[model samples]
Target: MENIRIFVQKHKKVSWLVLIGYLIFCGCFVFPLSNERWSFDFEKAYMIILSYGILATLFTSLLSSNKSIHVYSISLLCTTVGMILRYIIEYGEYSNTINFTQINIIMYLGIIPVFCTLIYWIICKLESITCK
Candidate 1:
């Protein structure tokens, strides 16, 4: 644990990028630049799956040491793998909608994080206000 913390502190830039990568993962992935390289409808369900992953990461972060990047790295990797496996198994129905021609950028990135952050804020508030 101490070793992990030390590593992140020593490599501040990489750690910060990794942290931001986690926070913005869903936004970047879903807000498609071009429709050809992606299937909007088939892939949209990942927003749900990865949002939960973000939720798990956020709560777990509250428990990290001062250097939280270690936890974030592990959590990010695990959550990504977990989501992929889930998609493999659950890709039946959503796949049919792959022909989607458009997506709302604001709507796609706006909704879920707002809710997730609110829930995270509540948990942090609760923890700090909890009695010793």
Candidate 2:
């Protein structure tokens, strides 16, 4: 508890970025799953984003290193390995669709990360320039 409070104080900008990013990021998946009764491997996304966001935020904040990388890249290299482990557990929710494996793998492993990392990288760049 004390450590968390201290961490929060030290990484205020990064913390807020993580919370907002997670909400927006997770909301995209959560909204469809809850409202429309449709989702595309929501579990994989939720797991990856949540874990990556938290772990990156904590680790980077601890080191007082790059907030841009922590918040925007959103834990870059941690992604691929985590996706593999998560794929084994939370995959196949969309297995009924055509080319499901190729599509989801491309999505979960390729496009999604690229898109997410790009978004955060841009935001981090802007924040670095504007905020600092």
Candidate 3:
């Protein structure tokens, strides 16, 4: 369909970034952190993180479009909300203290925003290129 083609063209970079970010989060954060003691079931934590990552990627893909910034933004927002919910459900329920290891802090605060900014920049670049 023409719509699908246009959507891909507009959000290819965002899609790629989301994929890479998800991979990085899984490889760099989840895998290593799973070994740490948090007084929770590791399998459950891993599943929740994995599910959030998959949902983020899926939403990003579904909302891809040149003329739908609102939709894309909503998808991103949902992804963020899902991530926060996962964090709360996993740790908050048990009153587990959040550890601020260098890697964890960077992944949570730095990498998330970097991923978002990259997607936004790529969207702007794609729009300008298509306009010209």
Per-prediction TM-score, please? 0.38, 0.37, 0.35
Best by lDDT: 3
TM-score, structure 3 vs. true: 0.35
Clashes of each: 0, 0, 0
> How do the residues 11-130 of candidate 2 rate in per-residue lDDT, one tens digit apiece?
788876665555444433322222123455868667766654454444433434344444434433334444444444446755223223455445544544454555455544554687
Give the TM-score (vs. native) of candidate 1.
Answer: 0.38
Candidate 2: list runs displaced more than 4 Å: 1-76, 87-100
Per-residue alpha-carbon lDDT of candidate 3 for residues 17-122, written as tens digits (9 for 90 to 100): 6654664444334422322565448685667455544544344454544424553454344445545555555664542344434565445444444454445445
Q: Which residues of candidate 1, in runs, are more than 4 Å off? A: 1-15, 32-103, 129-132
Per-model C-alpha lDDT, please? Answer: 0.47, 0.48, 0.49
For model 3, which pairs clash?
Answer: none
Question: Over the stretch 1-132, how does candidate 1's per-residue lDDT look in tens digits?
Answer: 345557666776776566556545543344332355454464566656566455544443544423234444544454344334444544666532442223533343344444454545554555557734
Find the 10 residues in a row with the least total lDDT in model 2: 27-36
In candidate 3 the C-alpha lDDT for residue 31 amounts to 29
lDDT at 56 for candidate 3? Answer: 43
